[model samples]
Target: MNLKLQQYINGKWVEANSGNTRTIINPFNQEVIASVPEGDESDAKAAIAAAREAFDNGEWASTPATERGAIVRKIAEFIERDKEELAHLESLDTGKTVEESRGDMDDIAGVFRYFAELADKDGGELIDSPVPNSISKVVREPVGVCGQITPWNYPLLQASWKLAPALATGNTLIIKPSEITPLTHIKVFELMEEAGVPAGVANLVLGAGDTIGAELSSNTDVDLISFTGGIVTGKKIMQAASVNVKKLALELGGKNPNVIFADADFDIAVDQALNGVFFHAGQICSAGTRLIVEESIHDKFVNALVERVKKFKLGSGFNEDTQMGPLISAEHLAKVEKYVEAGVQEGATVAVGGKRPEDPELQKGFFYLPTIFTDCTTDMSVVQDEGFGPIITVEKFRTEEEAVNLSNDSIYGLAGGVFTNDIAKAERCAAKMRMGTVWINEFNLYFPHAPWGGYKQSGIGRELGKLGMEEYTETKHIFQNLKPETLNWF
Candidate 1:
């Protein structure tokens, strides 16, 4: 695939100030696909300066909301026009199945369109005035320059969640895509330019998080910093953003629970359990890695899951028959291995897989066997921590309260799922779960219209829906008096 190998700043494609570059490898076969500029703090600073200048001085911020929405909608049209190529590049970069990547492209386009339609919908509101001959109103305005940092797991999809809203709301932004997976982001920036996004309204900086990401989070000129990644880095960004108290929107991820009640459709429950976690090799932030099952059907559900998991065909993302693909990198593969080892150490029994695949053909790529662990307790590290891999830790619960308790027993509360034939029971569990998103009789299903975020350490703020558009804006109240009367005593 042909890709532009430069940093996009102030509407121009340019190389890093330092002539350093990083080779991007296709995780499917470890083949070097392209080399992109390995930008540093200086590049980030330039991008930030450009965005700051654009928001503070340029016409983008002052442009009519309808015009901004039209640009955002045009970007979605461009995404649709190049969906196939974008899917292929996304698969090549992230080691996800091309089919999954295609679905993500659709969702990404939907996100842009959703924000575009929402742009002019919020024209603020008029409020009743306590004093006569006075008018009071509240309006939402752009938050100036924004900094967005997306992760490698879902590069372009995550970027759209930030980019669409930021642009639609007339905020200038410097987006730093994950170093390992920036191909699609580069393509999207090209499309954004094609959509007539003004110079410096959207900038792309490619580099490691320590340099590019650090500047985005710490730069005082930036009004908001949106991040989607691990908990450790999220906390650091939070601390750094405190320097200027920049508005933050973070999606740190979760060890989300998929609860199966005895009354649920056994076949469907088992099927969705695998679908929830195995999609994209279980790299999703809202992956249902923790299987909190009713004790009565626990063994039966585990057996069904193991049978299906064993039949999964793991291969190249481009292969139509491939059910799962490689992990993003060897480093990430090692992390998954360590988590599996930790699970075993904590006395969880590996029901199916716990080590790397022994297949010679798969050895060249970062492939791990789909693993399932039984006899897991809530206190197990595997059950509590975000594995971010294709591994499930099954924990049994005897009652409804116990199931809810087990599901809530984590520092993260991003998302959870409940499977039950009874609607009341499902609603009860969904209401009780502390997660930001709760699925009833489903899992890992999200769209552009709904708000996505977490309740606790899963991270701050919401990402989608009208609330998402609001994240890139600041609220202000205006009061005007037609007639003024001075007090006689003054």
Candidate 2:
């Protein structure tokens, strides 16, 4: 049986042009498990065309908001029904633990449910009119076709962040999942059609960023582009989308900060710090890789953290006991290794795990042990760059002012965390951090209704909450006559 994965386009599973295929390998076994139709710019353009037609003249856009929400709710129901099978495929493609994939499925389902309730609720307001006999009512309408590019870190979860709101607001979409992890998304679109999404409402393409991302951003027919990826790639997409002045929503990577105060709950802080960086092998864009700890407690925190990291299971993801999985690919693993070497060369001491695990069973997999580096400074590359791996850098600060200053030093202001028992101190630090999402007592705990995005180079616009749907819509004003006759003013 050839694990031939089909691309979902125009509500059908369409094969790519030339029929060239790409293999999907199991990262743990280094064995090919599936194959996908290798897509190109032409395929991407076709998806864009399909979405454009759907948003402009098809049934998807003209439908009422309440009806659209019903279709989205059905999509959610379909996903919940097939979640087990989808989660299994996602874990197979990305090398994440089955448990983590199940969690991602839960997030995906919740996103669609939230958007189902929110679609008709976010109605436009009626503005006060100053002119006589003139009444203006504001209207929010779809921005038309949206080109959404999702990363592989959490493929299904990221898609829901864009898909639910876009469809709910009557904006059609052409989504391009990272080719490295495209299986789960393939099945997702299969379910969308199964749930009765009209033809051309949602489409999928597979390819590297150069061919697919560039094509979608530059395509004049697309009204908006929503991307989630590294800052460099996000910048390139922004420049490309400027060709037609398309609306853009970028959820870029972060060099997030996690501050530990002397009065904090030490055990919880240590655990959060480890999880903030090492979970998913630290592949999360919002990884709290930079740790700013109070000088008085830095020593104790580092020791506890190092001990905790050592206990993490370093093996293949298929093993139920394994806690950490491999990096996305061999090249990424090498790049992460280079960063660790750079840290050691720059006078930072590796308090724990600077090299790949020596487990004979895990030799074939692209795995790295949970790593921690102490005596780090803001100027160092490890502190400045997003170490998108299981690596954490610890820096000590004498005062609250210094910690906040150092946390805000980087150009990234995506997300951050502050741990302090003192309410005043906690609020002070949280207010000073230049990020969009700030955690006071915890890190990475988020409600579905909260807005998420970044500041500065971290990217533009927001995702989730009401702001997310707004990103795919435009505002208009309507004037109605309540007076008997129009009064002419000179």
Candidate 3:
């Protein structure tokens, strides 16, 4: 589908109030793929006002849960119908391989479907009377207008995590996707409209984070704010949310650990380690960028990982054989390069790749090689900070206790992995790890049925599963007098 990129606000596609546009580039070829309206604070306020009006006056909030679920299911159907087009656009926007983009499309559809089926499963709950002839019950209600901010890495997938639950709960929301990757998001909004969503129920604003994001968090009309991005932005959003004391849900980046013990299946561990960080060029928030290995087999594991990294096919996303694509942009490529340089300066060995590939066809694109840093210490910046790029840091531990200590020594606790043949040890490590999600003998695997979030400074609240739908709702207690006269104490 050809896209004339514009913001979707009040159920209509419109230009930004700033009259400015930002060019969206295809990272694989350094070509301009599309241009979208560059919205500002004014545009954000306009969208928020529309959502407020809709929740307060429109039929959306009063709609039955079953009907809302049906609408959400219809939207999922539309996503399935346009899966190929959406996948192509996502790959072009984010510089991920076509296969990965197609997988994301499938997961995105599943998210909407999951929430749709869950909508009518329960309607709050009933409670017993505490006093004679009196009854009390707890019920869940929509949280009114929500302000949602999604990142660029998994544009539509992350948006689905927020959009589906908010809509299913009968709340009006305005979403501001990252300025660089807004194509798929805009397309999904079109689908929502076609699926019979009411006017102003789902709004989209396109712009930079400083303006659009700030307005969404600070707007008094917005009852909740959901953000997924870097730690700095998440902190700012939290402060901004204080303006109205709005509910906040954040999913920030992490320096996740992939722990491999001496007893682990070496071959599978190496493969899973590569899959965790190299996919999407290691831009994922929960990428296992840190590899904490048992000292007994650290050398062997690092050598095997380096060998595999050398054979990884890197090229344009359109190439069917390409295993990895370019970095998201020139700025991101530079950032990754800087991180590699820092690793070397901090006394870490550049075990595999430390520079960009020399292929002439890849020269024009923002490409970075799969990099590995061995002999890494916990004190090193590369091991401590989230590069958000295609780089992995290898750290060695003498004992299981040391490995657990090393994994939990970070400010991030988003996700982690434990690879060991011993199921008991895996379970023990999973329990000790401070992360929100831990994979035993696996890495980077997720489902719609499980909750995803982080501990410590990683972020606040959870997304997905039944807990996700609850994030968009508020609790209320209703009391009634079954057969009583007025209270004389009044």
Candidate 4:
């Protein structure tokens, strides 16, 4: 059965004002899964107005922190109850394996629960007054209405990172999920309403970035804009937000690197290296697509990686045996193909699995085999840019210094890793790595309790942990005068 999705604005499920809609296709089978409203500037304006009114009228902004936390916790409860359905919807929406989609659901629930627990624990700060007749204190308050734009890669997961913190901090929000993958996010809005979120406190607008997203960034009523997507869009959002001097939190792309040393445990490193790039078909922004190997083991490591890449199972997301699902869309599939073609033209060797799987059953879907390009240099397009697919580039480095230099050569500094047993060497490399999050032995292991973000062109601020909550708050100093005296000089 095909589902019809609508925008949620001012606590009501509604259709687009223009009566236009976009069909959502399942990347797994290229079939129509749902259709959502094609929102535009008018819908964004309505959502912005609703959020502003809710914040200005204290509908959510004036709620007691503990009460707000309780409401957020209730949302988490609803998520837990509907996790299975949500997981299936997410799998169908983005063409990820059900297992991975279930894992995203678990993480999403945990994010909400984490913010709920943290909401009331912080009570700002009190400072001793230097002035004899005054008391001074610092307090945190909501940043008013927040406009959030999430990506298609991990629709609801990225939205949770923005929505949970914004709501927990007593702020009203207007969220725009990716036009291509709004199903899971639409389901989440139902959960939020069921949790008793007040009318106009949270609104959803399903639309393209040019209209809804641009309006969100340029709207004066929105006190903050949090966006998660590619670098180009992130820069555009920043430029638009600058007009109003709104607070901005952006998480952009990364051409991350994974460094393997000669002294590293060969078998474990090989396993983790594969885990780094092949998960989610390497669509992750922080996936270690650039592999820096010690010259001594470069040949051996490339051989092992190629063998493993050749064996990856690709099929429909619903299939239990499918280790990796198709790319998000036909356009993304074409882009990945172009990158592989460029890699070959630039003199990189295709070690294994460099083209589409020759299976008739998978032809309808946007499927690409796990690809590895060996004998690569840092200047190669495949190594320098983010492919955002199941592709890896192997480069050889003799020393740790060279490895650090090679890893830091790119404009991105989102994430990197080192695989070695020597504690001191690992520490040195980790310290030298310019990325936001570095792993010594493991790859792609993240927790909700730790801060997640990047350096340089990667992003402007952090998300997750206590810092995530801080992104949605503003600081103000309150002063109390114990005694008032007229100025004699006047």
| Model 3 per-residue lDDT tens digits across residues 1-490 | 4775899999889999879999999998889999899999999999999999999995897899999999999999999999999999999999999899999988999999999999988676778877788878898889999999999999999999999999999999999999999999989988998999998999999999999999998889999999999999899999999988999999988999999999998899999999999998999998999999998998899989989999999998878999999999999899889989988999999998899999998998899989999989999999999999999999999888999999999999999999999999999989999999999999999989999999999999999999988999999999998888877895
What lDDT score is found at residue 440 in candidate 4?
90
What lDDT tens digits, residue by residue, belong to model 4 across residues 442-467?
Answer: 99888779989999999988889999
Residue range with the least summed lDDT across 10 consecutive positions in model 4? 1-10
State each model's CA lDDT, in order.
0.93, 0.88, 0.93, 0.91
- List candidate 2 segments past 4 Å from native: 1-4, 482-490
How accurate locally is residue 335 in candidate 3, as Cα lDDT from 0 to 100? Answer: 89
Candidates in descending TM-score order: 1, 3, 4, 2
Tens digits of per-residue lDDT for model 1, 1-490: 6667789999999999999999999998899999999999999999999998999895998899999999999999999999999999999998899999999999999999999999889888999999899999999999999999999999999999999999999999999999999999999998999999999889999999999899889989999999999999999999999999999999999999999999999999999999999998889899999998998998989999999999999999999999999999999999999999999998999999888888888988999999999999888899999999999999888888989988888899999999999999999999999999999988988898899999889999999987888999999999999899897995
Model 2: weakest 10-residue lDDT segment is 1-10
Clashing pairs in 4: none
Off by more than 4 A, model 3: 486-490
Top TM-score model: 1
Q: Least lDDT summed over 10 consecutive residues: which range in candidate 3?
A: 122-131
Give candidate 1 regions above 4 Å deviation: none
Candidate 2 residues 313-417, lDDT tens each?
Answer: 876666789898888888888999999999989889999999988989888888888889998998889999987899999999999899999899999999999
TM-score of predicted structure 3: 0.98
Candidate 4 residue-pair clash tally: 0
